[model samples]
Target: MGRLLLVVRLARRDLRRRKAEALLLLLAILAATTTLTLGLVVRAAASDPYGTTRAVTHGPDVVAVADEPGDPIARAAGVVAASGPFPVAPAKLAAAGRESDVQVVGRDPAPTAVDQPAVTRGSWVRDGGVVVEAAFAADFGLHVGDPVTVGGRSLRVVGLAVSAAMAPYPGSSCWVKAGCASGVAPGTVLPPGLLRTPGLIWLTRADTVELAADPVYLIDLKLADPSAATAFATVHNGTAATPKPGRVAQGRPSLFLQPWPEIQADATRLARDSQILLLIGAWLLALLAVAGLSVLVGGRMADQTRRVGLLKAVGGTPGLVAAVLLAEYLVVAVVAAAAGLVIGSLTAPLLVDDTAGLIGAAHPAMTWATIGLVLAVALVVAVVATLVPALRAARVSTVRSLADAPRPPRRVGWLIAASARLPVPLLLALRLAGRRPRRVVLATASIAVTVSGIYVLLILNRFLNGNGPYDAAQVRVLRHVLLVWTVILLALAAVNAIVITWATVLDNRHSAALARALGATPGDVTTALTAAQVLPALAGAVLGIPVGFVLFAALMVITDGDGDRVPQPPPGQLAAVVLAVVVAVAGLTAVPARLARTTLP
Candidate 1:
């Protein structure tokens, strides 16, 4: 107990004495934890509004469309109640100076038992008036009492509502008998019967019957066991929600069914993509965090060697000393983790879609699963970063640590002869990387992550510009996620570069001073440090092309497995990215390299 308190006190004292160091440690882990938390929680947060909508509207378990009206769907087990067998018309809507494909459903004046759409604004369906799906209404800025023209027949907007029977606009599962097609729907196209960018709107039975378009019928089924929705849908259709790409319907088919789960998946697809982007960004940030923390630990260890010796001179046990060293970083990790959790939970809802397809997500509940995972990340980063350094510092002989001598330079005759012929800066640069290869590795890794991101961005931009699989709305969602990830990734990569350069500067100070004393200029020394970082960055940028290709390829497989529209970035553009990486690394390392020039032997 006494040793624990002593360890805590010492660690606390050290942290208080070095506020900047503590803050740097905090920021490193914070970047990782916050992003990871966002990745972990955003999906749940996005689903919150859907769950709320489902409960409020009494959403159905399964929805089926038939050629003939009046519950033509075959009888199935676990049936409790049903709604619909309502008339459906796939028509074009001109409303509020906007036009789009719409699925007009004929509903009764009163709400039904199942698949009840809760009106969010104004009255329900009435004669000569239509109730637009909340998401669809929000998309075109349509309001209650707005003028609308459906299939060239004029109508008045009466209400706006939400339902779980289908996803929001663009990806609505409400299909007509002949099906529909938009610019893009779920990447892979299975046309003819595939529903397009259709908005859901409700009209009175009389109004829908008067419509000029060919009509279809749909029935919403309620299962006794909601979990059996997938089973029901599969049984009804004899297939999953997503049929094979390029598949053709041979003949006049049976009923088309959409389970609520599949509908929900469509509804939350944007958020799912964002979640995936964030998780990947989080992983990249974690690698940067590890690289940064390692360099900082190495530098801090060098600075604190004398302190460790002093502690030993005062009769502190090695275990106590090591515990004290590790405690400081762990303390910051814990605090940073707590901060990250709160920030991430609060920020998650902000990333949800702006469309009113579902109710706005509330503040996410901080589940133990999320908390445990984040805390574990923080602790692991701290331990992995500091464990070896702490043990090495602890086990160092008291006299050796007290002397605090710089690391002895290795003698290599042939290498020296080769370097001797080169310019002073180039010579120093080569040896700098040779002596401390790990720093070069870390720098390379950091630059590789950033370059890989750039490479993917180029390809993705090409995909968006070309005949890509996503719609405009989906493209916008992806762009937003990409922007966020790019910003965070660049920030962390910059930090890693600075940390690695500064650590290298510290480690090479004595050698740099000796080089100056011998004949090399301060300019030479600074150039050497900058060149060391740039060389690794160049290699990293080259390596990043393949890495980025692999990562983007994996993402394509996940999003659109058989998509052939994926484009490779032009070689000229890739060369520019590599040059940019090297230039950026040199810039990041400049001040730190100059600092090395200022240090005394």
Candidate 2:
């Protein structure tokens, strides 16, 4: 107990002393974990929005459609639940002095009672006047008793209501065909199209027997059973070769069953796209993590070694000493993980809400399971990062630690000597970077991570801008904006890498002098130093491809059925990105390398 408490106290002291470094590391971890968690949570939660909307609207499980007179699938699927052919009541509109088209949903209004859309403002359509959705009302500035024309007939807005069923307002925009409207026109209100106006009218079945407008599709059934919905739909959608033409092609219900599959497919597509953004965010976090930890560990290792010697002199066993050294990182990790989890929980709902709205569905609330998973991942990362550092501390000999002084690592001299033979500036840069392998590796990883992130982000931004086959020129613009942003970050990272390498070389002035005495030209020394950073940049780029792909795959919400095919990078674009990275890194060393090369020989 005494040893444990002492170790804890020592670790706490260490953390307090390096509060700034620890906080930076913690923040980096938190950011990565939060982004990853949010992505996963959003993907998981996407299903619920449509499910909730279905529940609220009492939507049918399967909606089979045929435009012709004799549609059979609707009647066939009606076995499990009450089903019927969908009725379309479209009409031209001239309401509130504005003219357009409207669709009046005509149904029995009673057979399917489970998922009825809730009335938000006024009562259901009981008689005389029509009930309008709050969204429709708000969009067109309509209120109860507002007069509107549909199908060349006039009607009064009797009540206002809202439904998950009607969340997607009438006449929503279509994917193809510009100026093709899917939703009801603004300033127009039409009910069942029974009252004729300037357009078509849908009549109550008893009011008029022969169908006025040809039904495009049939809504087979709406059930509370999601599993049944899927099973039935799978069988229906996967039916062996859709039936021959006129049999059920025109004004008749096709044997297709669309249920949760349609909704799930849509959500899944969005989820895939979102995953790409999440991936880019992850790589950014990883870069920050590697850079931050490298600095933290390298900067503090010497101090820690001395501290270990002191602990040994005080009769502290290696086990106790190791415990003390490891605890600080463990604590930081835990805190970061917790903070990330909280942040992820808070942010995921916003993502879900936005996505739901994008797909025209209700937003589902977040679940506790998501929070738990995020915390679990955080704890794992914390433990993994601290394991090696803690072990190294425990294994250091007591005598060496007690006599430890600020001395160059043994391998530095040989590396510096070998690096001197390289090209002028590159030689010096290599030696300088070679002095700290771990730091060099971290820098390399940082460059690679940043590149990976940028690439993924660019891909996603392009996707959002409508880059694929579905590109909508008017709404989306994927003009490499994310690529630009990523390049900016990479530039910063590359500059920092080069500057650090140059500074490391400069710090070893005595070594440089020794090398100069050993026949190293100033130009050669400069070139060697520059090589150190350039090599890492090269490595980062090479390693970035897979990481970029992984992120792309994870964030894609909707994609063509052809599978995950990365658009082949144009040779020009690839070359440009590489050239830009090289320029940024090389630029940083040019002045420093020149100065070193110009040194008095």
Candidate 2 residue lDDT tens string, 1-601: 5877887889889989988667766765676676766666656655666555566666666655445436655445434554445454444545678764444545454545533445555555543355564544554566777777655556667666543332233212111111122212233444442221111222333322222334343454655465676677667556422221111111212444556455444434344445444545554764556564644554565557788999889898888887887788778777876786676656655554332122244333355675566666665555555566667777788988887754474467677678657665566566566667776777677767776676665554543443332213211222332332354455446544654554445455566777788887776666666676677777777677667666556544333222233353455765566666666766776677667654433
RMSD of 2: 8.2
Question: Any idea what lDDT model 2 has?
Answer: 0.54
Per-candidate TM-scores read 0.91, 0.69
User: After superposition, which runs of candidate 1 have C-alpha atoms over 4 Å from their true positions?
Assistant: 70-75, 95-98, 182-195, 210-214, 243-253, 314-317, 411-414, 461-478, 560-563
| Candidate 2 local lDDT, residue 406 | 49
Model 2: residues with Cα > 4 Å off, grouped in runs: 44-51, 66-83, 88-216, 236-253, 264-272, 353-368, 406-418, 421-425, 467-531, 542-569, 582-601
Clash count, one per candidate: 0, 67
Give lDDT for model 1.
0.81
